[model samples]
Target: MQIARLKTVDLHWSEDGDPDGIAVVFANSLGTDLRLWDKVIPLLPQKGLRLIRFDKRGHGLSSCPAPPYTIDALTDDTEQLLDRLRVKTCIFVGLSIGGIIAQLLASRRPELVKGLVLSNTAAKLGTADMWQERIDRIRKDGIEAMADAILERWFGEEFRRSDEAMAWRNMLTRTPVEGYIGCSEAIAANDLTASTSKLKLPVLGIGGEHDLASPPDLVRATTDLIDGSRYVEIGNAGHLPCVEQPDIYAGHLVRFFKEDLNVGAI
Candidate 1:
């Protein structure tokens, strides 16, 4: 229940593994709060891995500012929080719109980001018309109107049929109306092709095989933009691999930080 009061917003954040361990910062997807990383955190090799996760503006207990938040503003919120905590550098992991935020943050402030793990995300998602339509729906009908449609896209048929799917659907419906709208607008405007192409930082892009939002080919194309970035896909998952298949999701992270670079380990 740790809350960091940043200048722009009051960000709700949490940590696990170790305070002095190798820092690994996590940013959740558009609809979810920091709790979205719950399953994935425990599966991580916690030897010396310090995990930092936070709820974005308007999500979870964090203060909701308003609608139409820019990606830069979201990144700035995170940067300010990290600065306040005295976390100078760390590997940045993000999902969905969280991934978009990670890319911009790394590009804008390379000194704070040592590496990147982008999961179930893309450089750009949905067309202007699609986002505008969604924006109109939220403004007119509210988030409850599109919760089912969002769930259908977020999960595969198998998970969609299970009771677990309802919980995720609830997560979406529970999201603040203004926060969801703001982040949707952020995603609509984000296209990291140019910034990502120049990133020299080590990157690993993970996609869910069944993800309709950011398919494997699209995520691979994102990896292709980087100099030596790599890509992988997890089965039995949709938009949120970290939620549906946490073990596989966490395994990739363990290998990257431990085997690949040998940074933080027990």
Candidate 2:
């Protein structure tokens, strides 16, 4: 992994495959590191592609600051990451909070984005007051307080019954409370209905059938707002479909990026 210092944050990233190939950057969800995409990345047909995955500021091994981070600031961090990588334009694959960042990236720096795959996310993440209260609770009592609730929302009941589910729960429990809270606030304040219409690049919106965080309806609504965007929903999965149903998720993503989006492979 290589660490680059951006203006507002330090980026931890890894690049694989042909250096000159079409670039595809994968941005992870909140509270998780780049390892969240472990199952999906290898399944991608990256014979002639450059795959980039990174840990966001305040998550994984990256920098962590105090609260009150804005979505725009997160977007700026992404822009700086791309600039440091020397990528003029690339396809962006983002999940959950990462999807919001992708939208802001396309809107703020259209020249840096060639295509987008937004999975389990929304234009405005419809976080209610209750959700805000929960975030506050995590800030005070720590992330452990929200672990059970997050696990319930992120995985199906059947998954929760399995040993694998317990491991996933452990991962969630290890998330930094400050980073999670900062991202929750960003989600609460996000409203991209107007900005999505301005995007002209190819986009694919995906959601899991059992996703409670960003359901199919929410993803459909987001796609509807964007011109020429496509939508796909995977069954038997929750918020992190790419992890739970990686083969299905990656198939749809690979097809969309390669054939539909016209992103050439090396």
Candidate 3:
């Protein structure tokens, strides 16, 4: 693990494989760390690729400042990370809140983004008032109160029945309440439909068929707004499809990165 100071925040990241290969940066979901991509990373064929995974400013091992964080701050942190690492351009793969950051990065710094893979996220992630009420409760009462709720939305019924439920539950429970709430605010306020529509790069939108948080319909709708974007829904998974079905998810990603996006037409 290496730390890079960007905008007074110490960003933590882990780099793997050869530096000469194409850079592929993986961003985690809300309240999660780089560990979220553990299963999916190894399944990827690293023949000509360098993998990079990092913890967001307020999540995982990264520094957590006070609340009221904006997407611009997150995008700036990413830019600094790339600049510090000397990574010229990369294929960005982001999930949930990370997907929102990816959109912002691609829109604001298009020259640094080679391709995009967005999973389980919406262009406008404004949930109903009732959901906001729950978020408020989390802000006041703490993330523990909403742990069960988050688990239900994140994992499928079958996975919840298995021992994997406990593992995932532990992951969610360990997340700091402040970090989660700060990111929740960012997600709540994000709207990138217009920005995404203007992008002319190859994009793959992946979603879990049973994802209630960012449902397949919402994912498809977001991708539809993007010109020439492709969509895929993995079966028997929920919000965190990369964890639930890592092999299948990585297979789809490898195909996109190797065959579709690497055609040299762009």
Candidate 4:
């Protein structure tokens, strides 16, 4: 187990593959922990890569501060964690809220991130009213009430019928309420469209064909803001393509890391 004790929070983090190789940091979606990348990590060329994953301030085993967190605060937590870990430069892959963090972090500290993978996310999610409504619903009925609906948005019909779907449901419902709400508030008040449009780094935007949370067209629209960014949509998948179709997800990642960024394996 590893933890980066930052000024505001102690982040739960892990590193895999070669410790001495170039870093490939992963930031998971809301309501998920570092294990979100379990299936995708091994598929990447590990010889010259240091794959890093971590839980943000609220989710996973990390310490949750309180509700009504800001995206700036979330991005700071990630920035502090990376600085504490001495990650000078790396390819950052972020999903959902994690993607917003990536955009904000890269904009704030351009030197820290060389590449980005925005997966199933957009510069701006739903409106504040929508998020507030969801937050209120969760506050009243707990995460379990929204689990079914959220799962529906996260996975396609085929994957939802499988046994693995139950585990994802558990992961969702078991998420700390304060953490979920805190991150929800942070997301509610964020709009990365302006900042993300200014990013000049190499970017790859990935969306799931069946993703109701972040549709392929929405993801493509954000990717189009970048001068030379590329967008790919995974078929028969929803928001969490890494969980439903890791092969396709990792394939795009490996190609971006190798061909686009020229990251070589030993």
lDDT of 2 by residue, 1-266 (tens): 68988887787888877788788999998878888888887887767778898988778877877777888888888888888889998899989989999999998888888899888998888655865997878878988888888877788888889888877777777777787888788888888878987788889999889998888899989987888888999999999998788999989987897688766643
Candidate 3 lDDT score at position 189: 73
lDDT ranking, high to low: 4, 1, 3, 2
How many clashes show up per model? 1, 1, 0, 0
Better of 1 and 2 by TM-score: 1
| Candidate 1 colliding pairs | 47-266
Q: 3 or 4: which has the higher TM-score?
A: 4
Off by over 4 Å in 2: none
Q: RMSD of each candidate?
A: 1.1, 1.4, 2.1, 0.8
Q: How high is the CA lDDT of each candidate model? A: 0.87, 0.85, 0.85, 0.91
Steric clash pairs (candidate 3): none
Per-residue lDDT, model 3, residue 228, is: 82
> Candidate 2: minimum summed lDDT over ten consecutive residues — where?
257-266
Q: How well is each residue in 1-266 modelled by candidate 1, as lDDT tens digits?
A: 98888887999998898888778999998788888998989887676877899999989889999767999999999999889888988999999888899999999989888889988877887787899999899889988898888887788888889987888878888889999989889888888889988888889999998888888888888877888788899998889888888898988988888665568445
**Against the hidden reference, what TM-scores do the models get?**
0.97, 0.95, 0.95, 0.98
Better of 1 and 4 by lDDT: 4
Off by over 4 Å in 3: 128-131, 263-266
Better of 1 and 3 by lDDT: 1
Residues 1-266, candidate 3, lDDT per residue (tens digit)? 68888875788899876567889999999867998998988887666778999999778888888887778878888899999989999999989888999998999888999899989997877564654786789878888888888888888988988987887777777877777777777777778989988888889999898897889998888878778889999999999999899999999998898676873321
